[model samples]
Target: MDTQYTALARRFRPQTFSEVVGQERIAQTLRNAILENRVAHAYLFTGARGVGKTSMARIFAKALNCPNTKDGVPCNECEICRGISAGNDVDVSEIDGASNRGIDDIRSLRANVNVRSMRSKYKVYIIDEVHMLTKEAFNALLKTLEEPPPLVKFVFCTTEPNKVPDTILSRCQRFDFGTISTDNIEIRLSQLAEAEGFTVDQEALELVARRAAGSMRDSQSLFDQLLAFGAQHITAADVHRLLGTAPDQRLIDLIEAMIDRRRDAALSQFQVALNDGVQLEAFTDQLLNYFRDLMVAACGAEGVQLLSVGRDCLPKLQEQSRRWGLENVVAALQIFADTKGRMQRVTYGRALAELALVRLSLLADMERLDDLLSQLKAGNAVVASGTARPTSAPPPRLAASTSPVPAPSLPAQKKNERLTPPPAEVASGADSPVTGSRDPAPIEAAAPPPVIAFQPGLEAELHRLMLSRLTDMTGTHLAKVVSTAISGPNRLDFSFSASYDIGRKACERPEVQARLESLVKELTGQDVRIQFRTVVTEAPEAKPQPAQPTNSRRKVVESPEDPLVQEVAKTFGIERWLRQEVLAEVVEAPAGGDLPEE
Candidate 1:
């Protein structure tokens, strides 16, 4: 006959209270309670699956009925201990609550509780998945729970405590078991590997531990799978292959490429991973975890440990930390966190993951404090040097050409200068016009033609002037609401869009209406009607044509001043205003104004 190799989890199942890992506090508390004879009639243990809830329950039962007990621990050699361990104890019963959760089961349990123990001082009943019990069953069992026989002890275990009724929870002493830590799981796995004569790397064990996600049963199951995959020795590469996980080296390479600003290399690495059939979401999750580790290491906390990778990777993490500032690391983490949620709804998960990676790489290019300061210093130097030098002086003015005709000095002077009579003579005698008169009609001197000021495009000019004056008076609140349009010759309409209640209110007020009317009359020298109406007039659209070249024969048009342009010029300074002035001068100046001086 050949002997078989029992799994490490079963081989090392905690037979005594002290053998349990990471649960010493729970064991000690239970032992103290038992010693003091303060044991509750019913006990409920709740936790994630497989953190030794069931095992602890069995240990407690053996401690209670051990034939020869020492310090609240069972003597495994005793017949009662052997019977309980073998699941054959006459007075101890293990019930699967999931299978027996009806009223009939409760009735059977009620009938059994009345009977005395066959071989032990107490009759112990253990029910797993107690949350699965039906409402009727719970109601039926409530009486038994409130007053069970002194010889009966009930133990209930459940993964989901919320499903259990409040009455049942209140009746039992609940013990909440926490998920095992990765360190504890790693230690356990390492010990098991050592005892089984199999070599395992630290990274491999850590991989197993993390894959377990803090569940001892899961870790043990994974350990068994890994052992089977790698017959005698387990390495990180083997673990990666078995778990379908990308290697840490590959991840480090990708991160290094991003940190180094090697966009092509990073993209190539991503393509390779995709070609290998590695899950995009999984790869992203791993990279995100790596960055998280880097952030932790950057924080300089001793407790920040990577449970999935080797300690050797810490150097790489530190090196990568130099490339990212605190803010960028935080922003990258946020992007990855958001990407994780988005990946679920997206049909093309690979593209989204790749996009996230590319975004992160670009974020890595963000300037650090020192780099930004250096750039600022360089810019300031250029500005200072360039501004210190004056622009080239306007080309030297050409000396007036010497006139060839030489006449009397006074006559030459008279020819160069215009001669005009005194103001009294000119005012009294209008017939004698001034010399060098380009316009002969000016001889009339009729009140100086009322100082005629030519305003090009009077309609547009009036509309702009009115908008500015109205905006200044009302501020932005009313300015945005009121719209002005040229209705007819020298006539402008004041209308309100649906957005402006204030505009309507102001228009209704006689004072505001009167003030606007007077201002228009003063500015345009035209009688204007300040009529208020709800109807909104459509703005006239200019016909579209091919864009005119700089020297094309198309007429140049000036745009009305908008609030945004005025506000920006006011806030930023006169530089923007000066630039606008220069543009206007360039556009309106005669064609020869910009010609090089000869």
Candidate 2:
């Protein structure tokens, strides 16, 4: 009985507007309006729980009714101020919308609203959880809210503003409160600890603040619990014990395992946590928060500030974040997030937790198909995910091979030697692979045709085919409408311009695309799938031609001023007159100078 005590949240609640945290802008505006006597008849206060919605309402009422009000602040010593603060004033009524949320309750409120105030100038009606009112109740209250008496001021507070009818909301001046920051919460806790002579560590204070999630009331309530439990001192270890989270070290180790693709290690750690009496749901929630921090850390310095975790936790997080690509981080989050729902459906949450962790540990295996294909093309040793490196390396290929011998690569075995270039000795007929051979085989002339991989580059080859084959078979119009064709495995896709709708429709007919595919198959000797569609895009802007690339193999382009060049450029709609004038200026200049300034 002697241990009973009032909660710290209620014991040190803010009595003045200035003491409000994390919502200074709203507080200052309200105080200015009250001083100017511009207070609205009905004010709606909205925000999350414990963010000071109800407290601000009380402060405003006290400011208006306190006998010794100064600078729009309540004088706590006054009779009216004390009564309003305690919710015992004759003039002030504090209603719980949850308990009396019917039309009859609203009618009763309307009847009393017009009655004169006995003790104060303004009769303030403060309703908490105002959104609990029924549809009819809200409709009944709307008229009063729209035009309440001059002496009656209504204040409705709710955690959800969206649920409140828009008609009712439009008539009231609404103020939204923001969640308190960890720094602000920590500072307040520090002040409370010093005044109360509690020996709480800064790390413990930080944990409490973060756990509060931007609610001052929630943080203060937690501080009260710690005081009751610890009596004299609170440490970081005490915070962890109270919170029931996996130890900080264990969380770090598990995440590192996931990053390194150590599936067994991560699963082992998860089993240890489960055996240690940790709740699967709580453990997963904490882990989700940990990764949430990792996500912010992944954004670099700009994101680090958002974590608000202890100093000891940030450096390692930043270092680890650099190794996790954004895709991997997002995928890991999704897997664990999805597990939360499945856990609720099953009695054994532990199994679900293990499955999710195992999935995370093997996340690296989920590479895009395009990346795997590129690796196949590069001849690199593509290590399978979640496995240790093999003592013997993959079959030798150009990207991974040290010796000059051709690689036994990923593509069809028949083309292995054909794709690889001949060794220098074999190519020059110096110590040729063939015995008793004086002259080498004609390599380039006899080399098999280059294999077609059905990549976009095949578009150029398709254009050449259409220009030659289709022009002969179907004529110029058909070939010209085709534009170009891009290829994929057994597939070719082409689109026609918006202006060429007739051609687009004609090519899209099953007969046309099939015929085109057959023509490609005849040339490449591989069956191809053909796709055609209509597309519209902005016309390309004219660009100045770039100077041609230089090498010894090709001759220089003709000078722009050449008579033949001028004629040729004119034929192509190029401005040869500009080039002629530039050439003429150079030709007319006197050689060796202008008579030396003398």
Candidate 3:
């Protein structure tokens, strides 16, 4: 039977330190340590999975125990090296800490450390997932690690260093591995494809690299999947379809729609993605990453180096950067990030995705810092230079200014009286028919009687207004008390909820009540009743507008001239007068020129 097709990852697992991809610094450091014969008794390698932790550990073991070591590297020809590579070396033990985490296993290991190597100079122990060891097991191994025999060495590998005890960590020399860049991952994948006699497009390799998300193992696994699916050559479309990723073009289109504030287009693209069965959470994550790239591009950073996207895509990112400043991109990223958490709880993930896209589109119009500053400066210049004023003639005066008159005594009325103002003509104090002298009119006599149009339960509007104003004044602390009921046509009974003790006390205070009553009387010309009760009235329903309400034919009201407009007018006058008198100004020719010399 034909052997099952081995994955490219396992097929091309690095045999020697030099063969490893994208971990030169780590490889060089370990090599130097070996060459100098200053190897530590215990070694701890930590990083994300698949960046060559396990592979490097094995290679280090081989280098340590090789028979023909000239500089502290394994000679592949050596019998010891071959046995270790084949997992048959008696002196080189590879233990899985996850399965054998009991104290007894560690005690067994401690017992074996004293045995001399039969075939090699040193006996090396490689413990994978070292963090899985129990506390007792860790303590059991600590004594041996602190003072191991000269012939024995320990290599502990873990993805999480924080889970390991500090004591164990203190006994080991640690090496941190960093994620490989997409460029490097792609280069390595291409080499594998070439060596395997399979044609792979560069874009396809890039897709594999990006899907890897900085893990060489993941990248290799993806490469193997793609090869298995296609059996030979692979294209970008195949990779996108297989990975359930949005096409590059579609992603660009979606980004462009967001930049243009075209919500409809964005929704349409999202629908297409939904129809294609793209994972909502994954799509959002990808878009966020894309926006991050745009942000980096906008900041003039080395975006290509930081991003897993293609080099050709850099231009698109740069163009998007020009349209969306860093702040807008950052805000979009935050909105999407927040949406991701919400999406997990939502059953309608597509709806959440669409909402996020629409929100981002709306936020695209937000003013960037530079643009806002520019606008503010322009406005300040207009204010400072006094240039944003109309040059039209001022309105005609309404007669001449009149002398002030004393206000008349207010009339006593029921609390239900309406607060409407009297007609302008009647209130203007027009000339009396018989009196020749201009005498001041009495305020009470000139004012019309107030009308009371009662809406049975509309008193809550007043209470809401009061509460809002109170909240504004007291910084959100005192507004909780106000409740209301229609006491009569013009009176609203105010009360406080049980929870608002401070508001109740304030309302009961004579001084506070008097001030509130005075403000109410001044504004509405009616005495409002203040009371404390637990009852609440239903809020009024909002009324719908008429389909075709009568349009008002009333004359337009004109606003009074503002100070800025007046100041601008005054400045212009000086300039105008100077221009008319000092500068050249043509006077009307003396009535149609004089008759030719008589």
Candidate 2 deviant stretches above 4 angstroms = 1-4, 301-309, 368-370, 375-598
- Kindly give the stretch of ten consecutive residues in candidate 1 with the minimal lDDT sum: 445-454
Candidate 3: misplaced stretches above 4 Å? 303-308, 365-598
> Per-residue lDDT for 168 in model 1?
92
Off by more than 4 A, model 1: 1-6, 273-282, 342-347, 364-598
- Candidate 2 local distance difference test against the native: 0.73
Clashes of each: 0, 0, 1
lDDT of 1 at 438: 18
Candidate 1 is scored at a TM of 0.61
Candidate 1 residue-wise lDDT at 51: 91
Instruction: List the candidates' TM-scores in order.
Output: 0.61, 0.66, 0.64
Q: Model 3, 152-206: lDDT tens per residue?
A: 9899999999999999999999999899888889899999889978998888988
Instruction: Give the per-residue lDDT of model 2 (tens digit) for 1-598.
Output: 5977778888788899888888888888888988899998989998889999999999999988887888888889988988988889999999999999999999999999889999788999999999999999999998888788988998999999999989988899989888888999999999899888988998899888988988999999988888877858889877766776666778889999988989889999888887886667768887887777778777765434444356688888878787776677777778888888788888978888888888876656564434544433433223334122333322222232223333223444342122232211112322221132223243332322223334554465445545455533343445545455554567776666688777767766787767877666655656878776777878899899999875555333336757755664465454534354444443333445332121
Ranking by TM-score: 2, 3, 1
